[model samples]
Target: MRLHVDERHERVLALVRARGSLRVADLAEELGVSAVTLRRDVEALATQGRLRRVHGSVVWPGAAAGAAPDTAAAPAEVRDAEGVVAGMVVPTLDHPFGEIVEGARDALEARGGRLVLGLSGHAEGDAEQAGRLVAAGADGLLLTCDRAPGPDSGGWVPGTGVPAVLVERAAPPGSPGADLDHVRCDAAHGAATAVRHLASLGHHSVALVLREAADADHLRAGYAAAVEALELTPAPGSPYLAPARLPEAERIERTAEHLRALAEEHGVRAVLLHGDEFAVVLVPRLRALGVLVPEDLAIVVHGDQVASLADPPLTAIAPPERAVGEAAVALLLERIAEDRRGDRGPRRHVDLLPSLRVRASCGAVLRAAGRA
Candidate 1:
C-alpha cells in the first residue's frame, strides 16, 4: 500500500519543478499524455503539497508566488497540458483558409485539449507533416484538406496510426469515416441554398467558378445535384469548367474569360464562386466584363471579409467558423480518451454543414431582357 511517484509521473513532476510554475500542458506534450490526464496528476500533487495550483500553472514554495501564466511559460515550450487531445494544423501561416485554420486550433484548446500546428506548403508537404505528427505521438489530428498528394488510396492521412478528422470536406470515396463528428459549415448544403435563392429571384442560367482543390470536387457535386433537382440545364455550350491551380490574379482573369464565353455561348447570367477567394478576385473582372452586379449578372460566393468591403457586396455561403473550432476541440477530447484506454478504434470523420449569407452580389439579374 505504498504510494510512490510512478517513474513516468516523477519525470513529469520533476519537469514542472525544474520549470517553475509550469503549465500542466507543457508536461503533457513532453510525456505524450493528454492534457486532461496530466491535469489530474497536477491536482494530485497539489493535494499532496508537492506544489500549489494557481490559474494555469503549478508553483513551488517561494517560487516568486505571483508570476502570470503566460510569463511562466518559457519561449521554447509548446503544447498545453491538462488536455486529452492534441490538435495539429498544417500550413501554420496566413492565407485565405485562415478562418478554418484558426477554428480548428481554437476548437482543440476550448475542449481542454492541446493544439499543435505544423506548417506545410503544398500537397506533398502537408501529407508529410501529418505523418510526422503521428510518429511524434499525437493521439489525433484535425486537418483542413487531405494534404496527402497523389491518387487517393487506402493508406491515407487517417490510416496513419491516429484518429484524424477532416474539419470541412468529405472523406475520400470508399473511405469509412466515423459519423458526422465533424463540425463544419455544410458547403454543399449552403451552395444549394444559394442557388435556390437565385432561382427564386427569377434567374435560371447560373454558373459556379470554383478553385481546383480536392474539396472543391464536393462543392461541384453538390451544385450539380441542386441543378438537376431544379431541372436546369446548361444553356447550350455552357458546360462547367474545372481549372487547375492558378495564381490569384490569373484565377480571376481566367474566370472572367470563362464567364464571358459562357455568357455568350450559353447565356450564363449568374455566377457562384466555389471559394471565397474566388469571390474577391473575380468581382472586379465581372465588372470589367460590363456584367453589372444584379443588373446584367449576379454573383455568389463562399463568405469572406472582401464580401463586406467589395463594391455592391457579395452574397455568400458562410461557414460556422467559430463552431468548427469548438467542435474540433470536442472531437479531439473523445479521441484522446479512447487512446488513453488503449483502444485503437477505427478512424473518425465529421461532416459539418455551411450556411448561406445572402447579400447584394447575388441579387436578382434583370429577367426582362434575358427572358425575352
Candidate 2:
C-alpha cells in the first residue's frame, strides 16, 4: 500500500532519529520512493526544523555534533567546528552547481567552519533566503544567481549585512552588487581556446553554434576575438542556434540540419558548440542526416558535463567550477576577517580560465600535421 505524505514523513523522521542520520540515497531506497520525492520531503522537514541536511545526508535535528553516522569519522577539525558558519545560496544543485557546492563544503570543513545551504530558485528570492540564513546565525554568505541583480532591484547581497562573495556570477558596473567580491569562470577565454584548438588542428574555417544562455555573450565575444586574431574564414549566418519557441526535440533536429547546411555551403570543417547536452543530441541528429562527425565536420563542446559520454567522446571546454567555489569561500573568509578587524579593502573580481579536454570528436590526430 502507498503511504500517505504525513505517514511517510513520520517514518523518515523515525528512521533518522534511530540511525542518527541517513544517506539520502539509502533513505530513498528504504522508503521505496524516488529520490526526487524523498528530496522534496527532506526539504520540507528541514524547513520545519525537524531535520537538517548536510550535503548528501540528513540528520536528526536534536542530534549532537558528529552524531550523523556518515560524518562521525571526520577529522577533529571538521567534527569540532566552532568557527564561522557560512551560508551558501544557489539556484539549484544541478550540473556545475553540485561540484561548486561540494568544493565549498570541503573548504569550509577543512577550515573548521560549517556550511549551510539555501536554495533560492531564482534571483528574486535570493535576498529573502540570505536574510533567513543570516537570522539563523550565518557569519558570512556565498551566493550564486542566474543573473546579476539590477541596481534598483533591492539587491540581496547588499542587503545581507554579513560578508558575502558572489560565485560564478558578476555584478554589472555601477550596480548595487558592484562593490561585492565575486569569482567566475572566464567563459570568453574558454570559447577562444576552443576556436584556437580547432584552428591548431588545421581547421581554417570554423563555425560557432550557441544556445542562448547567460554566458552566450561571453562565449560569442571569445569566438569572435579568436576568429579575428587567426583570420579564419567565418561560417555563414548567426551563431545562435536555439529558437526559444520550438519543442526541445524539434529544436535539436533543426539545429543539426542548420549546421549541416552551413558545413556543406561554407565548407566549414569545424564547429564550436555551446552546451554539452545539446551537442550530444545534435551529433546523433547530424549523423542521421548523413553528416559524419570529425570526418565531415569536427566539433568541440563548451560544457564538459556528460560530454565525455557522447558517441566518439566529444572534446570539451571544462570550466574550473570547483576552483570557483573554493576561491569564493576563501575570498569570503578574507572579507569576514577584514570586517572583524575593522579593515576595508578594494573589491576583488576573480576570473578563472577553463581548460580544453581533447578527445575523439575533434579529430586532432588526423590533422596534427596540417596545423598552421
Candidate 3:
C-alpha cells in the first residue's frame, strides 16, 4: 500500500532526525518513492519548518552545527584546493528570477560549488558587477540583462577571460556577446500556447494586455502568430493598455477600463495578461465595473507567481524559470572545465519551452478532464 502524505512526511523527518542529514536521492530510494515525489514531500516539510533543504540533501533544522556530512562538499581529492565559485547577476530577486536564482544555487551546491550573487539595474552595470564578483574569486559567471543585448550595448564581450553563460537573456546576431552561451525560456511559444488554450475553450476572440518590459516583445510576437494562425479576431486598440509612467492605482484603473471595453464593445471574452501582479488587481476592478470573472470575461496570466492566490485562481503560462537557471549553471560549468583542459567548443543557445497551469480564471470546464 502507498504511504499517506502525512505518513511519508513524518517518515522523512524521522529518518533525517535519526541520521542528521541525507541526500534526497538516498532518502527517496529508502522510502520506495520517486525522487520527484520525495522532493515534493521534502518541500512541504521544509515549508512547515520541520526540516531544512541544502544542496541536494535535507537536514534537521536545529542540527546545522553538528549534522551529518554535507554530501555536496568537495571530495577528498580536491578538498585541499579552492572550491569552485560562480557569480550570478540579476536585475531583481522578485517573482520568476527569485526562483531562478534558488535553482542555480541548489545546482551549484550539489556540485560542491558556491554561488556569489550581484544585483544590477541595467545592462551597462552588468560588466562592473561581473568584474567585482571575479575579483572576489568567482570561477565562472552567470549574467542576466533587462533586455536583449545589441551590437552597441557593450555589455558582455567574449574575451572577458572568465567562463560565463547568459540566463534568461540572449544577444542578437553580430552582437559582442553573440558567441556567449545562453539558456532562456521560449517566451513566444509560451504566449502562443496561451492563445491556443483560449481558442480551444471556444473563445473566438482574445485580447492581450501587457506591461512594457524586455519579454513584452517576445510575448507580442507569439500572440500575433497564434492569432494569425488560428484566424481569430483580436480586440481593438493596442495591447499596451497602461503606460508605465502612470501611478500604480491609476494604471490598474486604466487597464481595468480597457479590458471592460474589450469585453463590452469588442465581444472579447478571453484575455491573456502578462505578469501576475496586474491580473490579480485587475480582477477586483473589473468586478466593481459589473464584469464577473469567468462569466463576462476569462483571464490567463503569463507569469505564475501569486496567480494561484487570486480569488478565482488564474490559469497561467509558466516559464521554466528554475530549469533555465539549472541549465545555465550546467553550461557554465562545462565551459569552465573545457577552458582548464585547453579545449574550445562551438557556442550553444538553449531555449526551454513553457507549460500552461490550468485553473479557475480561464473558465476551463475541462479541469476534471486532466486539462488542469
Candidate 4:
C-alpha cells in the first residue's frame, strides 16, 4: 500500500471506509508518512466521529468496536477510483527496497488513492500477508515476488478480485508470458553495461560476485550475453558464493580468498559485485590480501545502497528502483480504475534501464587499460 500527509488523508478515509478500520503502523507505512503525522490525521477523523481510535487500530463508524472483519463496515460505500485503497507488500524497508515502497506511496498519493503496506520478509510468507491485506480491504495490490509461487498461490498478489502489479518479476509461467501489469529493471542491459564498462577499461575477463539466494538468473544471463558479445571468458561455475544471510568477518575473508583464486585461475581482472554493503566488506578484505582495488583488481557494485559513502566510493549500476515502485503503483492504479470502468484492455509490462555509476573503484580499471 502507498503517501504525502495532505496527499494521503483522503485515501486514508477511503481505506477506512473499505476496510472498516486500520492500524497506525500499516497506515504510516502505506502513506509514506511518519506515525506521528498519520496519528494526527486519525485523531481528526476520530473527533469528527467518522473514525474511532481503538488501541493500535482505527474503526470506522459502521464497524464494530476495534474490529476489521468484512462485515464490520456494512455501510461503507465503494467509492470511485479517486479514493481507492490499495495494498502493497514488499520484502524489506532497508536500502533499495525502501525506495520502492516510498515511491509507491508518493505515486498513490498523487492519484488520491491510499495504500496499506505489509512486509513479507521471505517467500514462504508472501502468500499469507497478501491474503491478509486483501481481507483487510485492499481494492488493488502491488507486490514484489522474490521466488516462484507455491502450488496454492494463484495469480498476482493471489487474491480473487484485486488487480495487481508485480515489481521486478516477470510473468507467463516463465515463457515471456506477461500476464499481468509489471515493472522491472532491465537486468540484461545493466549487466551488459557493467561488462562493457570493464572491457572498455581493458579488463578482458571480469567476474560477478553475488549471494546464491539472490534472484540472479537474469543477471547471469545478461553477463553471459555480454561476455559473448565481447568475446571474453566469464568466471567459471557462477560466482554466487556469498551466503544468503549477512556475511560474518571470517566468511568475508574466505570469500575474498575464493575471489583471489578465481582471479588467478580465470584471469579475472575486474569484478562486479552485489550491493555497497558487500563492496564495503570485500574492499577491506581485499586490501588485507594485498590486492589494491582497480590497481590490482577493478571493482564495481550493483545497487546504490551507500555506494557513494564507501571508502573508495564504489561505482554502481544505479537502477531506478524507486521509479520501478512508482511505476508499479501507477500501473496498479490504472488497472483498478479501468476495472471500475469496465475496460479490460491489454495489460502493460514495463522495464526501466539502469546506468553505470563510475567512481574511483572502477574508473581506475579504465585508466589502467588506458581508455580514460
lDDT of 3 by residue, 37-93 (tens): 999998999899999887777878876432333433533322211267999988889
TM per candidate? 0.65, 0.76, 0.81, 0.72
The digit string of per-residue lDDT tens for model 1 on 85-149 reads: 45465554554357666655543443345567666665446567777777777777766654433
Q: Candidates 1 and 4: which is better by lDDT?
A: 4
lDDT of 4 by residue, 1-372 (tens): 445555577888888788776667677787778899889999887898777775556767886532432323222222223567788877778766788877777555544467788888855466677788888988887877656644433343434468888787766454433566778888778887888888988887888877653346667778789999999876765565577565477668877887777676666778878667878888888888877776778888888778888877898888888779867876776677677778776877799999888888986644756754
**lDDT of all predictions:** 0.62, 0.83, 0.83, 0.72
Worst 10 residues of 1 by lDDT: 72-81
The full ranking of all candidates by TM-score, starting with the best, is 3, 2, 4, 1
Among all windows of 10 consecutive residues in model 4, the one with the lowest summed lDDT is 71-80
Instruction: For model 2, state the Cα shift of residue 89 in Å.
Output: 1.1
> Using alpha carbons, what is the TM-score of model 3?
0.81
Candidate 1 ranges beyond 4 A from true positions:
1-81, 122-128, 134-137, 146-161, 175-184, 236-239, 242-251, 264-266, 342-349, 364-372
